[model samples]
Target: MAEIRVDKLHKAFGDFVAVRESDFTVRDGDFFCLLGPSGCGKTTTMRMIAGLELPTSGRILLDGEDVTFRRASHRDIAFVFQLFALYPHMNVRANIAFPLKAQGMPRGEIRTRVEEVARILRIAPLLDLPVSGLSSGDRQRVALGRAIVRQPKAFMMDEPLGALDAEFRELMCGELRALHDRLRATTVYVTHDQLEAMSMADTIAIMNEGVIEQVGTPRTVYEQPASLFVADFVGSPAMNFIPFRAALAEGAAEVRIDDVAVPVPPLREAVEDSELVLGVRPEHIELTDPNEAAPLRARVFGVEYMGTTQIVTLNPAGGGTLKARVSSELAVRAGDNVGLHLRPERLSVFRKRDGRALKSRLHEVPHG
Candidate 1:
């Protein structure tokens, strides 16, 4: 396996930029993910790293050796596409053995490696079957098997399970992560799915437009997003933003919402903006009775039952609608008045000007 380093990598098509001057490293044997929405340049970034696309500027290093301009075939990197790129004319065994055969390995060696990959993928029984006859999941396994058989320096997967059904996609995610752990292979996976990145990546790079927004562990990004785009993009229900105007000094412990003082984590930086945004995840909000003298009050608008938990959507007295994940047993109904108690330490404050998060104690702690 190889440690991949991308330094000031940039890509452009005429006047439009696909990837800006991005810099991030994929440590040897790490499952790093480039996560973002469609046309956010994640797949483009992965392509550049895999040598499938040339960077307009900057360098790519594999284990300290520069390979920025290397051809895709010369990079010793295996790429698995979203749609399984298999030869319908060949059987699964042949597809798996193709790479080794192209390298002129002995027939016996090819057979051993092919069988080994088949067993690892749990597709040994399907090895002799025609590629066109296999199921989507099996074909995806075959695609993965083909990549694994190469024993390359690293693996680049561009939404390899994107073609499967939701249930199968979830199943493949676990399988793929397990395969990475077993092989200890350096892998870079590209996906727009937050669940996939959160569940699988050792480190995640959140991209927006052509720029890299933030890079951190799944927990770090989810809890302490560097920018508003990241905070909004990473979570399922997404973080709720409550807008207000405040002139807060560093070390201040509270802010006024609708003339009511609400406790917040002490601001590590001063905010002089006429407009600011307070972000809180649904799960961090506690709903209380409106008569209880809580800091914030809201009227329940809707309740979405989600098995063990229900998402309570409410209209805050201050302004804007926010959702709170509460126990399903709580008797919350539409038009019910409720007081919202936001967890102080878990709140994130952002500047509406540049959409950047204010440095707080939550972000100051070194993430493990």
Candidate 2:
């Protein structure tokens, strides 16, 4: 297992810049994910790391050795692409053993390696099947099986679940996570799927427009996003942002929405503005009694009763749609009036100039 380091990486095509001066580290034996939307240079970055795409400038290091100019074969790594690039004619067992054969291993060693990986992936029974006849989920396991058969120093997987249905994707995620726990290889996974990154990665590198926005554990990045882009991408239904002005009301610093005044959370530094943006998660918005005089009152505009909770869309008593997650038994219908309450300190403050969260250590919300 080895740590991977990218320093001042730059990739360009003629006049276009695909990746900027990017830098990050994937710890030894850690599951690191490069996450972003499509055409955001995540693939380019991964290809560069794998020695498939040469950077316009900058160095790539594996275990403190420079492999920036090394050919893909010279670097000890295995890559599982988003598209399952399996050989159509090969049986599952042969496909898994192909890498070993390429290395000129004895037949006895190859069989042992292939059977070991097949058993690890629980695909030992499917070895005789041709690649073309397998389900998308099964095909994915074959691709991963091939990568791990050699026990490469580092593994790179790029959206290996894109071809599967939602149900299968969720199942594959669990399988990959468990497989990762056992292999403990230094792995770099690339995916635009935020949920996948959150669930599988030990460290997430959230990227946008080719530059890394933040690098941290899932919890820190989710609860305290460094910028507006991350806050919007990491959560379900997204965090609600209501632009408003800030001020001192009575003895507390507060944000004013129409006629309502709600106190701002305690911060590490005094805020620089009388005007700011407020960010709150849907789950943080609680449904209160209609008669309770909360700072804000919303009229339910629609309700999506998902199994465990309902996402109630609301138009503030003043106006503007905001989503709040409530219990299914709350018994609210479209057009019902619902009072809103929140832990004021849980509120996130972003600068009006650039939309970065103020540096504050939040007290964890007591799980209900």
Candidate 3:
């Protein structure tokens, strides 16, 4: 296994900069994922690391050696593309042995390696099936088997599961994690799916518009996003952002939203007057009694009954929409007036000017 590093990496096309000065290190034997939306430079960054695309500036290193200008074949890396890319005429065994055969391994050793890979991927039964006859999931396994047989320094995959159906993709995610544990090979995966990255990666770098917004473990990025862009992008239902203006109530800080003065912790005096955006995840908001004494009130606009949980969309009395995730047992319907309760500790406040979290303004107080 090799530790991969990219320092001050940059890529541009004429006037368009596809990647900024990116700097990060993928530890040896680490399952690192580059995650973001389309055109976010994740694939471009992967291409550079694979030696498929050269960077305009910066160096690429493997195992402490500078390989900035090395050719793809010289990088000692295995690449699995989004498409299966298997030879239509070759059977599973032949396809899995192709790399070893190209490297001129002995006939006997190639057979041994092919059987070993097939067994590992649980495709031993399909070893003799032609690629044209294999199912999509099996074809994906063949592609992975091809990569595994080579025993390359690191595996670089670019959306390898994108072509699979949702159910197959979900299964593959778990299998990939298991395979990583078995081989412990360094892996750099690039994908636009947040769930895929969150499920399989030991570390994830979130990219946006060619810039890396945040890099952390799945839980860390989900819980403590560094910027509003990250907070809004990484969640399933996305975070609910409401605008508020600050005020002082009983020597404590308060924010006025839709003419309702809701109490909040004190902000740093410097940013007291800055326009603020209150961010709360749908799962954190709870349903309460709909009464005049309730701090906030809203009318249910819609309800979606998911298998285990229901999503309730409400149009608050003030304006705008808020969504809450609650138990399916909670009977709610459209046009039903309900009270809303914000989980104070779970709330995030950001400066509207730059959409950065107001970490200094947060408190650790218990919620009522």
What's the best-to-worst order under TM-score? 1, 2, 3
Q: Candidate 1 or 3, higher TM-score?
A: 1
Q: Which wins on TM-score, candidate 2 or candidate 3? A: 2
- RMSD (CA, angstroms), candidate 2: 2.6
TM-score of each: 0.98, 0.92, 0.91
TM-score of 2: 0.92
Instruction: Give the per-residue lDDT of model 3 (tens digit) for 51-71.
Output: 999999999999999998999
Give the runs in model 1 whose Cα sits over 4 Å from its true position: 366-368
Per the 3 Å backbone cut-off, how many clashing residue pairs does candidate 2 have?
0
Candidate 2 residue-wise lDDT, 1-368, digit = tens: 99999999999999888899999999999999999999999999999999999999999999999999999998999999878899999999999999999999999999998999999999999999999999999999999999999888899898999889999999999999999999888999999999999999999998898888889888878877778888898999888887777643333446677868776665665654466677888988998988777778889899998988999999886667789988888889998888898667667777778767765545344223
Order of quality (lDDT)? 1, 3, 2
Least lDDT summed over 10 consecutive residues: which range in candidate 3? 359-368
Where model 3 places Cα greater than 4 Å from the true spot, the runs are: 247-272, 360-368
TM-score of 1: 0.98
Backbone clashes per model, in order? Answer: 0, 0, 0
Q: How accurate is candidate 1 locally (lDDT)?
A: 0.92
Candidate 2 error regions (>4 Å): 247-253, 363-368
